[model samples]
Target: MPHNPISNVQHDVMHSLYMNHHNWLYTWIRRRLDNQFDAADLTQDTFLRIHAKQNVDLINEPKAYLATIAKGLVSHFYRRKSLEQTYLEYLAKQPENLAPSTENQFIILQTLEAIDALLNTLPGHVKEVFLMSQLEGKKYQQIADEMTLSLATVKRYMKQAYVHCFVLMENDFFE
Candidate 1:
């Protein structure tokens, strides 16, 4: 096998970390999720994400680092499931002919996840106005009344949301 000194060292460190703590991390996640299958998957994801960072040697507290990564993965797992369920519910209510193909569901879920991540970066009121207008089909005046804000403020929030989305799209960062 071809050897790159940096990658070889990283692999060894990652392997050592995994061998030492996989069981503990898996058990911790399993208890939280109450499912061995998901726990195992997330445990693997946590390690893979860490491995991908190529900085295994820099960690001083290996277990602590692994635990932090594992916890974040578990949270992401739940968030993804919630997003999928919400998308499914929305699709279920759509007219039969308007439903996307089964193959498109995965892509749509990924897109929604990306969009949700993007929205999470916005201020609370900005995100609220964007979702109310785009998802709930609310008028700006309605959002203003519900949010107890002036109509101009609501419009500005919507404008900010749209501009942010447009910039991300322009850079192909959202794709």
Candidate 2:
């Protein structure tokens, strides 16, 4: 017997899910995740879960489906945050190279969170461009030539990355 219409839809959805929606899904995941690694991992997990489903349809409301996936990702984030806090508390109780003052610890955590939030908002390449220029201290022309992107494109991407990080910072993460 041939596959039913729902099965056919499921096949189609599975085939195209990652390919067609990768960027959108990444953006969605990033909004809720702290950093590039977490965002990338969760985005990959979202697709993996979809793939693992026995059968699913081409969802009439892909946006809604995507939102549901994001919620799960957020829950994962909270769980991770709790574990990290526990690890940090344990580390505090251990002998260390240096003890962190409460203010310094707060600053470090805020910086990490800000970095995570910024990374989530940025596109992969844009984030790369910004990192290459800022973290590596490369010139814009150098970044453009290295990435084989146009100078204007590199500048635009950097500008977008800056705006994203700036907005996150302005939210008073440092305060």
Candidate 3:
């Protein structure tokens, strides 16, 4: 195959960025996480995320760009860890006979992650209202009173949340 000059240029930029900043990025992540293994993994993930974007040439401040991406990855890593810990704690409290098998537990965790991702897509107020109604079983009037929102506003937020979820579900189904 013929060499593509644009692709080669992008590759060169990425290589230069990695060579110049990989160690610094790794150390920065390591300081935040205090875990060499996770730091190394997230550092590589950071590079991979940048590469996937195909915008290496546009970065003016390599360190700042990389730090922003790494920060998000670290946040996600902690969130996932917290979710797993919570699930494990819940499992520990379950009766032995009622506990799910390992495979089932894995499936349940994946489902929970999917649900979390879906909820995260909603606006903060919408998500809070939906959770209060669905998870906490709060009435619309009660939620409105507690949140200082009108009852109609609470109902609208719930409607928005349900529609958002339904659209996402439909897209997933089609995909």
Candidate 4:
């Protein structure tokens, strides 16, 4: 079978891209994530995403595309970091600190796992609003405006969501 010249060029470009920058991708992610294991995972995920997209001819610069994918990984990492920080701040206010003991890092990890589960249980709009307000530092009125909802509706949603999150934390039950 004869391959078209354009197809051959694309294949050569993609192959060279894979060869030249693959190892550097992990370093790029590790710099942002500060964890080699997670960096390897993210680097693999980046290439997997590029492969899944099959965007050979469309991307003018392969390095730029890799950088964009790495940036996305960084953004996701920071988003989770912010979520964990918010959860920790919430936990700090509780009367009981379950992870207070020196060897109770396991307990803290478990508590964070439960909080993550509970966060997923929230309604879409409510969750977005909560994230905007608490994580992104948006004001209530700002969230209402951004969501195109009445201020009272925003307030009600936030209150209900907060109460649910608080109760879940208080009970130490995520289900």
Candidate 5:
């Protein structure tokens, strides 16, 4: 079967992209991380993501493409770190006998991370309302009163949030 240049030369294109952009990407992430070791690791991770995602068979703006992917990796790294710290603080607050065992703690932490990732994509107000109602166990009226939003507005926000989450589930965001 014959294919166009785009499909035929994908490997060459990817190699060229890697050669041209990998060093710059590494330096960029390194500067942000302020630690050479972590920077190197994340740089490799960035490329791995591109390869796995197959987003680099064509490179129009190599630097911009690499930077965007690397930036996402950096953001995820920070988000995961914050989730870890929050989880540790939660464990600390629990009485010693009541806290989960070490293995269970890891499971709970991963669960929290998955939930956080799901919520992170929602709009600010939608996310706030969702969290207040779900995590804080607040009533819709209480949420409306606390945020100075009308009851109707609160209902709309909750509906929007729930719909967004349902869509994500349908689209396999959980996977």
Candidate 6:
């Protein structure tokens, strides 16, 4: 292959950034998380996220940039952990014979994560309306009553949410 000066410069900058800040980032994440293992994993994830952007050369304050990425990751880690804990607790309450197999449990958890991600993309009111109708089995009128929204507004929000989900699924299918 040909020598690429730009690639080499980016590589060197990334290497320097990682070498200078890896320890500090790890310690910072470790301070927020109880598990050392999770802290380590998230620190690596933070670096991977930055690498994906291919903008290491643009970062002027390396530590601040790293901390910002790490903070978002830490929030995501806790949210996923909380979701898993809730699922496990629900499973624990199920009759032993009714419990899902480990493989199914994993699949269900992944589906939940995907669903959560999709919902996060929707506008707040739309998500709330959709969740009320789908998850809580509430009627449009009931949702309207509870939220102080008109029935027509509730229906509009639900339509918006459904269209958002459909567009995302269509994109995924094509991809």
Rank the candidate models, highest lDDT first.
Answer: 3, 6, 1, 5, 4, 2
Per-residue lDDT of candidate 5, residues 1-175 (tens digit): 6667765566676777778887888899989989898888899887877777665665577788778888988988888888899889888998999998989988887877778888988999989999999999999999999999999999999999999889988998866
| Superposition TM-score, candidate 2 onto the true structure | 0.44
User: Compared with the true structure, what per-residue lDDT tens digits does model 4 show for residues 50-133?
Assistant: 766766667777778899988977786676677667766866886774536634644665566566668778998888888899
Q: Where does model 5 exceed 4 Å of error?
A: 1-8, 55-57, 170-172
Backbone collision count in every prediction?
0, 1, 0, 0, 0, 0
Q: List the residue pairs that clash in candidate 6.
A: none
Candidates' C-alpha lDDT: 0.91, 0.77, 0.95, 0.79, 0.86, 0.92
lDDT of 5: 0.86
Per-residue lDDT of model 6, residues 30-113, tens digit only: 999978999999999999998888888999999999999999999988888888999999999999999999999999998888
TM-score of candidate 1 on Cα atoms, chains taken together: 0.89
Comparing 4 and 5 by lDDT, which wins? 5
Please tell me which predicted candidate would have the highest lDDT against the true structure. Answer: 3
TM-score of each: 0.89, 0.44, 0.90, 0.47, 0.82, 0.91
| Candidate 3 local lDDT, 7-87, one digit each (tens) | 999999999999999999999999999999999999999999999999899999999999999999999888888889999
Cα error, candidate 5, residue 143 (Å): 2.1
Candidates 3 and 6 compared: the better one by lDDT is 3
